[model samples]
Target: MKTIFTAIFIILLLSACTKTLDIKLRSTEPKIVIQGNVTNSGGPYYIRINKTVDFDANNEYPPVVNATVSVLDSNTRRVDYYKYTGVNGYYISNNLFGQVGHTYKLTVTVDGETYTASSTMPNFVGINQLDFVQTKILNKTRILPQVTFTDPAYEKNYYVFSLAVNNVTYKAFYAVDDRLTDGNEMVQQLYMDSSYIQKRDFVTVILSSVDKNVYNYFNVLQANSGASPTTPSNPPSNISNGAYGYFGAEAVSMVSQSF
Candidate 1:
């Protein structure tokens, strides 16, 4: 069943590890960062707007208020206007429910400049089960979460998995595709740094069926994960017109298990 993961915030926190750049950033015009999502769970979808801080500045993200934002549902040909709550850069949608196989378009105007993006909600794929395995590396034991699901052979699918340990979130984004094992029952393990998962910790995994741009976004981050922090390189955002962030649609499934 579809349950238990928050939107906008997850996308913000999913890229949490990218903030650890070692070199101090030069002062420049702060770009508009938009974290928007349309989900199948229905009503009151939220989007967050914020500005980035300097590399060595405090970790707080300042909200960008009074922006005009709207989302268009292609299937219904209707638009939902979002009004800012004037806190946390959040905007609330009025009367938009996510549907599988429908495309969504997001438009945001800040300071007379507008940015646009599009994403489609794919069919839902639930988790068959969750399992755990232990592996030794460099003389240390690591706990890995195994996620099992059957991929549909008729079409291509891309997914992103979010992990949390004892209610504490992990710092990286995990993404996978069904290129090699399409139509088969696939068991995928999430591998992190040594000893990250400990015994008796309650682990939560959220599997998201996302569009290609969203998959490519996280895939780029996963690939450049080992780059030097001083010269960090992130993939260009899916949003257009010079904004930095993503507007996505997610069909999700989640499960929690004890480690």
Candidate 2:
């Protein structure tokens, strides 16, 4: 009788353990990984998706095939969708052309998981004017370039600035000091200051991009959103007759001094 009771207890314990393991396995959800790359040519862009990684696994990323891909332009006019190539997780747009003045919107869907990202085409903010000025920094030289903009502003302001050594554009670095100053008040000066001596002949100050809405925000507060007092292209260009223009397309020019 004692041996039979012991055997029965062991069997019950094992069955309970199995039930607990099944419950734990059913509670977990799958993860996803997203990867992206852009090209320098006029058009053609691609994106890939895969299963998310786990810390315990050696190769966490698993290719996600048959996912959907879509791209939207700045004007919200041009939108392109890519078809999956059927090789375990790849998508491509053959006719998509990325323009400097345009912005892009991307969406990816796989295994009931969806992800989205949007970015504006970093326009080459043409250097309207630049000149070197004497500075107190002993080891460094200062190149003061006056930047002007011909584009209009938008809402939800933001900006990203970059600097590059002219010939080798590959190693472009963010203009640490690059920025936009308050358009409202007249500023004493706006230019970048750095430890690196910018060779006027070899270096170029670049304003990669700026938020149109933020640009207009600065102007609206300062009461300069007009072409009369300033030039026709001055502040408030992002506004169309008092309402926010283009739903998402806003442009701003960063003056060198503002940086």
Candidate achieving the largest TM-score: 1
lDDT value, candidate 1, whole model? 0.76
What tens-digit string does per-residue lDDT give for candidate 1 at 59-119? 4668889799999998899999998855578787888888889999999999899999999
RMSD of 2: 21.1
Each prediction's TM-score versus the true structure: 0.84, 0.38
Q: Supply candidate 1's per-residue lDDT for 193.
A: 64
Candidate 2 residues 3-84, lDDT tens each?
6434433322221100000000111234544434332233334455555333334444556777877777757477788776
TM-score of 2: 0.38
Each candidate's lDDT (Cα)?
A: 0.76, 0.39
Q: Find the number of clashing residue pairs for candidate 2.
A: 13
